[model samples]
Target: MTFDRPHDLLKRSPANPLIVPEQVRPSRPDWRVDCAFNAGVVQVGDETIMLVRVAESVAASAPGELRVPLLAEDGAGWRCTVESLRRDDPAYDFADPRMVVLRADPAQVYLTSMSHLRLARSTNGTDFTIDDAPFLFPSTRYERFGCEDARITAIEGRFYINYTAVSDLGIATGLAVTDDFRRVERLGLIFSPDNRDVCLFPRRIGGEYWCLHRPAPRHLGTPEIWIARSPDLLHWGRHERLAGAVPGGWEASKIGGGAPMLETDRGWLQIYHGVDAQQRYSLGALLLDLDDPRIVRARLGRPLARPAEPYEVTGFFDNVLFTCGATIRDDALYVYYGAADRVMALGTVALPELWAAMGV
Candidate 1:
């Protein structure tokens, strides 16, 4: 599909939806790429590399049945398996697109599509070539369900990767670091269960590493953005509530950290996504204090960009414009987002134009 600038604040790329499921090769022949989006982006040398989150399901399933992929814990690491369930069965409920839960035992659940991280490289930040093999797949216990939505922050010559790890225990943020993309050192789970959408600051602040994350509230508070500090990037502490969903606003449902923050003379510029009651997702900005990132200085009253085009309005999951990463080059901000949870797309916004919109 052609990428037209449906919204004026952020110009959509003509090559929008640059990466689609068809372009991505499945890890197994029996598996199929359901969607490719919500990628973590970084710049290595002259190439812009994206750690794309690719969700896959079985190639075929019997009529009136749903087949889901499972990674069994084998002594040698893991073995891929599939589970078939009768859709008409009263014991199962498929109310959510992401997972299926047993009506009797709510704890017992299976993901509709297994997710993994793959590499996609581009020299000019537009055209990309996807890697053949899986860059990071399910292996350990935390990643039994699969790893999803990677956020890359290059610090001290090494890229510190934060992503979502799904399993039976609950969803949490997982950390990993890599000097080269070929090999990664998994640091295990950093945030506790019932939390995700972690984005780290590029450098140290006041001798401590800082990050923004979202914790899913069970029965009390609603899902909101929170900040934390770490002395060694391993053990995090000093947690404080940053921001929450704006009631009766565009992001009235929930809000979470998006692309990594960019340090600027004004403050730390951050891009975040929010959902309303109708589940329409939109991108907004938050300006944090340069020294104290916990202090939110300015915020965009309106959406920077939202689902307008047909590609964004309909797909595997509709009306979503989620971004895991973005880059600023020569004063232009390039945002890589997943449109309707089906394909990867790029949006460009001049820094000056964005600043004017933010009134900062």
Candidate 2:
């Protein structure tokens, strides 16, 4: 199958930003939604479900006060901390819009908003109905900061969710299991601090479970994707480097796993996201050996999807195209992605064409 544009393998939906912040009411009356993005997508019955990450900011009336939600010492709920700063405050540093840092002590930083997962459903894979209430929130000390991107993998008739849990300590991966989306069984933090983007394979391989994750260093090393194996889903081991950013491309800065791996006749087809020096994010692919997923069979030299459209190039965070979920149906791939870290969008590509493009 030949494509008109090689990099345009995925076709964006006309109904872009299927779900936005305005469509979802904040979990609390005093909070206003800032953005909704980076959702985990799955197919259930006849509907396509998305677990969306919704960031909310506190409604503030005070002129100079910044109220941020942080995990309370008890580790079960959130406590808002108010920081009043003046433009001339020598100790205050406001370089990043996402965070407020202390000039005197760089270690002291606070987030501008809090994020939680919300449920959205669509029957046609384009138009969606967003839930008013949050499906998952910062319920634990580890998740006190918030729960960001979620990746859902179905195995043995159950769905496993792996999400980034943020707190004062740093970022970690948290796991949850559900038979039905109604109730989730929390598995606490599976991967320790300084690690995230944990995506599990659908089934056991070589008599063990496998997962792809990114271990980000605080100061020294670059963020790259790694593969690990485990007998139980809770404890992971035997970590090995999967892929890294290739300098001078859209993925020069860092790369991480995107959607859950799709089993194909060629091998395990995995989609991942990469960021460049300019902080632009794009989607790429990798083919792994069926027997040993750690072995990379092939990789796409170029990105399959990039930030080009109006909605994709501008928003909360500009030039970002991140995805955590995708579903296969009727010989086509439905990819649900977060555009510019502000809203959810959908894209599609023929399955056989995608496989052919990979050249595996």
Candidate 3:
């Protein structure tokens, strides 16, 4: 029942927050970065690269104006259009600082700021050099609201990225392929609306590519992890429930895939995130069948990592420790996560120790 605390299994870097909003400049002059978090990490030669989600807010605007950015369909070209709503307007509800919703139309909600992915490179796993401009921005109508929580998997010498695309249609998974990180090709939306937290397996399984995703149902079932298969990576089918929240544990409310599943001798080592009833986020592990990833071999009853340190316990969102990706080198697993949804931090765990902690 009681598992070892996260601090015992995973060791937090003494440097703590490796990246923060002040460490990286905004992509544009008019925009100010509010937070830089939820980065997908990859190893390029000797460098550690992170595709970080940067949330930006516009400069001072007119009083009582709630400015929001959305993708514009002007027929000329793809661009960002800022829409302003008055705070005193009776039709709108601005009770949530994160988003604004229309009182008459509950389904219509808009984020307060625009989000984009940026690049940050580190020689060691701790300190980083962030790029001045955004590496990936909102281009298509599906990502009009923003592109967030990217997970990268290297397949056949090419890197394929799956990210959460947000819009009025809802949150969906979008795909991008790149031989080199310099130029990326957008593959459009792969999964439909109300689905997110998708991570594609690095290689094919049983002649079919596999992906782990979460589909959140509004009125019927709770949000749970699911697995889907595809032969060509575009059209996905054969959906099966992989895992769901445990009733009396840390992941009581919802669960989703975190990093891409890591292949090990025992099975497919999957690191995932779970939200408790209090909305606190933590990380856990799942051992899935190597031949048939749909079958869950074993799952950690308790979290492998959770918000413990001061940095992880406070910021944009409190008690949050979320990771999009991680890198394994030698005998150590380097976990790069978003701390409190405001900054990036690094945690290191020995492979043997982590396996032991998970009882694998």
Candidate 4:
């Protein structure tokens, strides 16, 4: 629960940080570039499609040793990271450059870091027009440590991405398919290591193919919300546990699955992400069972968005707001948060006054 930075919303974005970090490397070290803060969005044709997850850093010739790098860009802007240190096993150690894991030697440890899932375009969603190439990367093997966030969905017409692969053998959940995002059809890791905050459930009930996961019970407790069933979205099963964590309220400290639910007649309206116990991070809501969406009818004690602006408190991991994606055209509800992971912010409510202040 310690946070500090130059903050004031870092870049504040009149432009520069809507998403920056073009592409940097040992090209001399010290200009700054780091990305990936939950991404995925789609509207297609008329424009409005992004799938970012870009992170880049490099500097570690010897002294103390440190070199962080990651890339994956597609928006007429090219940048890719990962040449291969192949898990440099001088013995193995790197839980984020020395949080502690030991044993490094796979030819001098230079994997740098890798991730892929890029493609940005917009027709006034907030000025953007990129795409020189790179729609998906990290070609399998559970993705050699690349690709994060992404939860597009789309269904019926076909778009169902799932993202978050990462490697060395952990964070898995990859599957892809497209109609014409320029042809992509890879379906590998369905949901492996410890699971992630999945999505999908734009439509489909008794017929199957519902989703919304977050299976990390590391300490053997907390971090809940589950529900599966996929006749073919990649073979999931009936596991249910719709929601949890609300002991003292404001989401007691865990919850996930945001954007991509909104239907609201009185059901299927979700907008998760809540944390407290000092972790901060906010935004919450639930009201399922539009046909047994694992049945959690009402929820929302407080927090339709917290971490009071100033770009949600600070940077790199401060108060945090963290949203994967959002959009609701007309009556407004275009929240695309990420602020505090570094940048990116666009707030709006009035979607029936934010679900009537989330007290439905």
TM-score to native of every candidate shown = 0.96, 0.94, 0.95, 0.31
Residue 245's lDDT within candidate 1 is 90
What are the Cα lDDT values of the candidates? 0.90, 0.85, 0.86, 0.66
Candidate 1 global CA lDDT score: 0.90
Query: After superposing candidate 1, which stretches have Cα over 4 Å from the reference?
Result: 1-8
Q: Which parts of model 4 have CA positions greater than 4 angstroms off? A: 1-36, 39-54, 57-137, 140-146, 150-161, 164-198, 201-207, 211-230, 234-269, 272-284, 290-303, 307-320, 324-338, 343-360
Error of 3 at 303 (Å): 0.9
**Candidate 2 per-residue lDDT over residues 52-117, each given as its tens digit:** 999988777466666766656544545644344554566767677677777654367677788988
Best TM-score goes to which candidate?
A: 1
Candidate 4 lDDT, 1-360, residue by residue in tens = 444432221112344246544532213244234554556777766777877665444433345555444344456543545232324544545555312344544323323445466677778666655454457866555565567777686888888788878766677788788887888888777788878878778778888878888888777788778888888878898787888888775578788876667666778876778788887877676778788877787776667667655556766567877777776777666656666665556566666665565556
Against the correct fold, how does model 1 do in TM-score?
Answer: 0.96
RMSD values for the candidates in order, in angstroms, are: 2.3, 3.2, 2.5, 19.9
The order by descending TM-score is: 1, 3, 2, 4
Per lDDT, the best of the predicted structures is: 1
The worst-scoring run of ten residues by lDDT in candidate 2 lies at 1-10
Tell me the deviation in Å of residue 66 in model 4. Answer: 21
